[model samples]
Target: MNRLAILSVSDKTGLIDLARVLVESYQFQLISSGGTAKALKEANLPVTKVSDYTGAPEILGGRVKTLHPKIHGGILSRPDLESDRADLTANDIQPVTLVVVNLYPFEQTIAKAGVSLEQAIEQIDVGGPTMIRAAAKNHQYVSVLSNPAQYNAYLEELKAHNGETRIEFRRSLALAAFSHTQAYDRAIADYLTKEILNEAQAKIDLMEVSSTGATSSQPSLSSSYTLLCHSPKPLRYGENPHQPATWYQLGAAPKGWSAAQQLQGKELSYNNLLDLEAARSIVAEFWNDAPCAVIVKHNNPCGVAIAPTIAEAYQKAFAADSTSAFGGIVALNRPIDEETAKALTSTFLECVVAPACVASVATILAAKPNLRVLVLPEMQQGTSETVKLIAGGMLVQKSDDLPATPETWQVVTQKQPSPEQMQELIFAWKICRHVKSNAIAITGDRVTLGIGAGQMNRVGSAKIALEQAGDRTKGAVLASDGFFPFDDSVRTAAAAGITAIVQPGGSMRDGDSIKAADELGLVMVLTHVRHFLH
Candidate 1:
């Protein structure tokens, strides 16, 4: 008996060709619905409308077309069992040996500029998924094809195997079809639930819903957002020996890093990704009209400097902590020129990331074959959620994107900051806010001289920052990431000839600190909000 094939598709890329082969060579009767039937009819192919075979007219604006018994019975029937054949005969249902279907343009509909929820809802294919699932359930006999990418290979296999596609191939295609439907349903359900129903709901809600409803039975916290993790590739190893790690991309739809063209280098490790993230963030802060150098060690900036020339910036940043930067990751805001590359090659560094690496510069770096070179086209965009794993759960917060403007700055001292001091104060404030707290950064000539981060006390951080600045502290401006709990921090900075100070003045001893600043003839400004990056 001739096999029955059903073809229903929203994307008719290679539909006509496939239909021609199925009809002429395989002698498979084509059953189609709506647009697919119309397309086949237009091409003058012998096609049976699904409603005709099902003995039911398309109803409810075509929604009730394929949900009838005849279509589903043929799709769900098991050809191996005699009882299944008897039931098919009793129901007057011809076994649907093959099903080729692709759903409506839900992805395309969502991608449209001003698509509404109603429009998106309408595009969700009920019949298409139902038919695909029915076919997949009988994968032992029925071959299901949902993607056009599988068309040519499937046709070749059918031609080679005397119109009988292999069970293995059919099973794989069935799996793909199910996955396609699952991802499709997920996109629609997620869009409606998150965007239309609750705009403020976390992105993880979709994943949680999918996990609960789908095959994956993983439990998820109601309050927590779901992190869509993808390991693009395996890494060399982790941070240290005896620890295994892999880099995971965060977003459900990744545009960069995970998709970036890795022109050269070995596999990236967990620490590599952490250092790269730090380098990318720091370089992004100074990308526009400024040459900046950022040396990152363990997801924290060891040194960062801005200058007229990339070489000078690298030199100043490296000089800040040569020991820490020995095997660190270096990022440049500007393009890597020959001079910059030469300076970079002089030192032994683990990785270098920039927007563009010059041909000559790339050739120079090629001397050190193991040095990982990455050309990031754009800086990493800031995320909306910040996640930190606690003992048993996770702590979540809205990312700190607090704007630092001159209007927001408050001058709390008897001696206000000079105009030059105000410029450096704002610059230092911006840099210090991004560093780990308790944080202190000393800046001069639009470049960071020293930074002290993640310390116990604010004064201890200030002293460490000043000590690193050394002679550079004389004319440098200092910024404390948070308030000075005591007047001693003010006295310490004053003795270092710090010139000016910027901090969040919430301390009860603010008057004493102001008095100390006045005695040293230091310029002091207070920003009401404290930025502690830890």
Candidate 2:
């Protein structure tokens, strides 16, 4: 009695090789479906189509192929139980020892541009996941393989065990199969929710055709969320030395923080990753062919600047707050040239992350043994939901990837801002958006003079920012993450000699703040875009 092996897969990565080995080395009967059957037949291997084995033709566009009792009975039969043995004999079902299957490319299909809902629905492999789950659930008597990469080792194991697979290997393959199906279903669910939200947004746009410039797109609620967690690599230490940590990658393709490849330096610490993310997020805002640099300390932007050249940007960003730049994370929008690398190496920086680095420049940074150099092309543009863990459940939200413009703000003050003042205010607004709650950013000449973040009160943050600006506060502009609840902040800014201010004006006493600005001879702009980063 030859053991039966079911080979049904959408991905033909190692189908022929695995089929030939199972047939020749292991002496197993090949049972395949659809494309897998076609490929195996082309290889001149003796194969039985799943429909032929089940005596049921695939109907309803091949959706009804593997849902038959004959196909599942073989994989699910328990040879130990008398009832299970009788059922298998009554159905003339042979025990299926191996199931080589992989799900359809649902994620890749939907990721393509201009894909339709119907098209994506078709790509959702109904029978593939069904078979995978069935085999995985009955892993005691069945072996499941979902990835083609498992072929060589599985063949080796069978060859070693005299055409028999161990329970441990079978259980691991079952786990992999289950993970594959879960990820597939998750991709389909996420894509469907996205489509529904897009359609809903389209309807809203149709209803409010006049409301064009508002925040049109938001991540809508989905039924379920799934993350394919894998690739666990050990780290030196966690946030603290006593705590243990391991780095895990989510999904197959690398993006954002997961995409960073460290080139030169000591091993990355837990705090190092946090600062890197903050710097990357900030610099990504100015990644549009501009030379922008951001210096981050403890997950807050201490210095940020944009200049004609990357070296100049790094210089201006460093000059913004030299005290905080020491031992801080540096992120650049442009590649590090020789000049920029030399300038960066001059500082006592912790890490330098960019899209690319010249070989010689990487060598120049190599001179600093402790400086971590990371190259991440995905930093330029990528979309991912922000998920944070709480006490019992999780909080999911859309990332604040909204684009800002100087034109969107309303000039509310009697003393309207000058053209340069508006530009300065917009630049300040962009930085303030990323700062912690009760944040204040003071800027002049396209650079941050000072930032007061995570203060308990808006006035306290404003005072700190103004004081940090010091002499520069006389001509600098100010931006607040939220609207000032009281007029005292306005008075404080004006007293600091701040010329212009930008904030989201939604407070009940907006008139009082406006009156204070008017009385103090100050220019104020209301962005109506409150960015409270708590």
Candidate 3:
């Protein structure tokens, strides 16, 4: 009896070559299903369909094709066991020596625009995973090829060993097969979780219209959902020297932090990853044709600016606080052109991140071999949940993705901000949300003049930011991450020649703060929403 190779795949890359080699060189019988059978037959190879091999027609719209005893028994039989061998011979089922199977495109299905729940669920592969696991579990006498990329290497092994596979090679292939199945299941779970969350949101919307019922399984409140985040890449160190760290990307499809590919320099440290995400998140806020740059240090935005061109954006953002921009992480929204790359090299920056870089500019950045450069195309899009670990429990919350519009901004002060000033105020508020608590960012003409982050007191942050602004404070507007408790911050701003202030006006002493802004001739706007980053 000839050794058999089972081939069932969604991706048909290199399938014909693998099938021809198995038939002509290895003298192995070929069995396939659905599209794989059609593809192999088209190539003029003698391929057996799973349905025909099992002597049973497919049922339930091709879902129950390979779930029969003949298919599983052949792949799962133990050659060493007399009873298993007898069962296979008595059932007239030929032993399956090699299994080539790849899962359905569940990730690609859900990724389509406006994909429905039914469409997503239908793409989940049942028979493919089952066949893969059956072969992998019996790897002692079976070889499972779970991916098309494995075909060339498997063919090379047969060529080297004269149509025989080593035990070690089989074990490695089994491990790869297991990994593929696990990643496929994880994608399915993530899609289902998002579906549940979407339905829960719909329930909330219905409740807002008329309070009637509540959803039992709210994604935000439930802790039982299987949230999968695999693919761990070890890092050099954590935030400190003695601690260890690793980077684990969430989900199967690459996006956000997982999608960023480090092109050069040392491995990303924990602090580097933190600052990189902070810088990228700030840059993500400005999703438009205009170029924008954000500089982050200690996980806070020190400088940020948007301009007509990439170079000027980098120049203005760096000039915001040249002292802080030194050795800081830089993120750009647009592709890094030669001019921007040249401007960036003028400062001793720690890292430069962008969606894409021109070839000439990448060559320019390559000069500084130690500078960490990342090219992540997914930076242009993002929407995620915030997960936090707390004492004896976990805290899950919605990301602070609220937009600041005119309807949400109330002119609480007797002095309302001018149209131009209002735009600048909103811009400052957007940047402030990304800054750490006790944060104050002074802005002028839509560019940050100075930022004080992680200060012990609100007044301290205001003073530092004002001091950095100096002459620029004459026309600059101030944005606080939280509400002001006392009039001291207002008095400090007045003394520094600050023209306007934006804060969440929720403190009991809000009256005093409003009065101080009125007396100082400062335009104060209250955004009922509070953005507190601790």
Shift in Å, residue 281, candidate 1: 1.9
Q: What's the lDDT for all of these models?
A: 0.82, 0.86, 0.86
Top-scoring candidate (TM-score): 2
Summarize candidate 1's per-residue lDDT along 1-534 as a digit string, tens digits.
888999999899999999999899889899999999999999999999988888789999977788887888898998889999999999899998889999888866776789888888889899999999999988998999898878898899998998788889999998988877777776666566557335434444565567565332323324334454533456777778667667666433454577555446676777888788778876776777478899988766778888889989998888878988898999888878988888888888888888787777768887777788888777645565689999988888877777677787878767777788888887788788878899999998877778888999887888788888888888789999888888898888878878899998898888988888989888888888888887
| Candidate 1: Cα lDDT at 523 | 86
lDDT of predicted model 1: 0.82
Per-residue lDDT value at 1 in model 3: 77
* Model 1 pairs whose backbones collide: 204-226
Preferred candidate (TM-score higher): 1 or 2: 2
List candidate 3 stretches off by more than 4 Å: 14-27, 42-45, 114-118, 139-141, 151-176, 196-273, 289-291, 334-339, 354-378, 388-395, 456-460
Please report, as a residue range, the 10-residue window in candidate 2 with the lowest summed lDDT: 211-220
Cα deviation in Å at residue 517, candidate 2? 2.8
Error of 2 at 495 (Å): 3.5
Pairs clashing within candidate 2: none
| Per-model TM-score versus the true fold | 0.74, 0.88, 0.83
lDDT, residue 28, model 1: 87
